[model samples]
Target: MQSAVYPSLAGRTVFITGGGSGIGASLTRAFARQKANVAFVDIARDASRRLVDEIRQDVGVEPLFLACDLRDVEALKASIDTARERLGNIAVLLNNAANDDRHRLEEVTPALWDERIAINLRPMFFAAQAVVPQMRELGGGSIINFGSICWRIGTPDLSIYATAKAAVHGLSRSLARELGVHGIRVNTLSPGCVMTERQLRLWVTPRKQEIILSNQYLKRLIQPEHIAQFALFLAADDSAVCTAQEITVDAGWA
Candidate 1:
């Protein structure tokens, strides 16, 4: 692993959502390296447990893994409550859970649109709501949300996903304003085409890869670790003055 910009999360508790795999999982490991007490949630029980075990064995920091569907607001709140009781007050809340529905415009139904929004946008708000009070008691906190470059430069079959991520940007800004006095910072980490397992399985074809690389200045895929590094910055004291802003880690694609 690369050297951490801000080390020594020795006493902080970080709560991350969707941490079973992909970028969330990467963030979990990165924060653990800094010695943060990490708590993460994912509906996938096995994957979550595996990550928890790896962190414990490798770094000697046991992370709390909650199995819950984030789309269920009640379940999300309950999970957050449990995490707080187990890991102490949440010093960092990473709203990293999201879903992408790549359906053509004409193929999208009203029900599908609503479902996408609920999955991609609603959880961030509720997760933050659940953590804010705990953070307030702890004297301050950071909420790092995951946004997408697809929202910035439009994608063909991801209309609803794009719209939902754009709304996340708005949520980050408004929450930053609302929580500033309470010492809570809200920010969006917008990533470009970081090739993950899911993306390789569902989106990255030979033709698609060629097209995506053609638009980027670097012409190389961005790694989850790159975004993980940025999330660490936003979550730690280094980004104390940074809030309500969208930090892009897209290899300058956008």
Candidate 2:
């Protein structure tokens, strides 16, 4: 699919989480191709390195890939600081790191629940907090928080994930109101049933695929690049007035 060029994104600084793979990788590539100074943090060192190389080779732009676990708040903060130092004041932030491993409610323990929250939700708030000063200093910026459609459609075996994702919209709304005065836009970008390699490997059996396509208004599967294109609009000045909105790119699913 062809992506629209956002001239405003050129030379802007963008920070993304989990940018080594899946939708995050697409986000990184999209921004980098637009000449944005992209910095991304991910625990997957090998994949991240390869992505940096790939971008450098493909677009002649090498994104800064910081290997840091999002669960460690200090490390996450440090990575953000490093990105700001190396790239510039971040004008866009994509909180795209998340784990949507399905688990039964009866099997969930307190530790397990906290772990899910740490990966799925906690880092988003802290990452936003870390970048607010930069955005404020720049006089404007965009924060695109990753959300999910599972909770909206009441998908089973994802209670913890759904809870965290539901909370993300609340977080976005509250932050949008607080930061709008500073010219910072906060909004949630929820995706539905994207056909990532991980999803195909673990889920997305033939029967499940049929169900997904049948439910969507569009018959095609949702791709990471599809989500990336939406994110590009959100990150750029094109969506300057769009804030506190929960935009879903599910091809009309849910």
Candidate 3:
């Protein structure tokens, strides 16, 4: 599939979380290809470094990679400041980092629950807080909060994860209403079962893949690039009027 080019994205500053691998990596590459100045935070040091090298060599525009744990709110804010100091005020913020480990309800201890919420839900709110000023200063900006279809479909073994994902929609809509006056658009981008490397390595057995395909309107599994393309549209000025919405690219799976 051919991707659309958005001239408006050229030279814009974009900040992404968990951008070292999986769907986050695809979002990094997609924004870079648009000639956007990209800066991303991830805890995976080796993969983040490699991503920087890859984009620098392949795209000719090197993205800034900061080693950060999103759970640390202060550290996350500091990383955003560093990115801003280097790349200019962020015009697009992609809250894409999330941990989706399967957990049985009975096995989910309080500690595990807290960690899951920290990884999947908390950072998104704080990240938006960190960047909203920049967006306000820029006159307008796009904030794409990554959500999942797992909760909506009531998938098994994801009690904590599903809870966090479901709450993401509320967060997005609340921020949209609160920040619209400042011209900062906040929307939740919920993706269906995307075939990321981690998902494949950890969960996607042949039988599981077959089940996923059988349930979806489209037989083919969703790819990271597909999600990236939708995100590009949301980030660009093309989606200036779109906000407070939950847009799902699930091939009619919902």
Name the best candidate (by lDDT).
2
lDDT of 1 by residue, 170-218 (tens): 9999999999999999999999998777888888898988888888888
Q: Give the better candidate number (2 or 3) by lDDT.
A: 2
Candidate 2 lDDT over 1-254, as tens digits, reads 56699999999999999999999999999999999999999999999999999999999989999999999999999999999999999999999999989999799999999999999999999999999999999999999999999998999899999999999999999999999999999999999999988899999998999999999999999999999999999999999999999999999973
Residue 197, model 3: lDDT of 94
lDDT of 1 at 180: 95
Per-prediction TM-score to the true structure, in the order listed: 0.95, 0.98, 0.98
lDDT for model 2 comes to 0.95
Candidate 2 — which residues are off by over 4 angstroms?
Answer: none
lDDT of 3 by residue, 50-129 (tens): 98899989999899999999999999999999999999999999999999878778998899999999999999999999
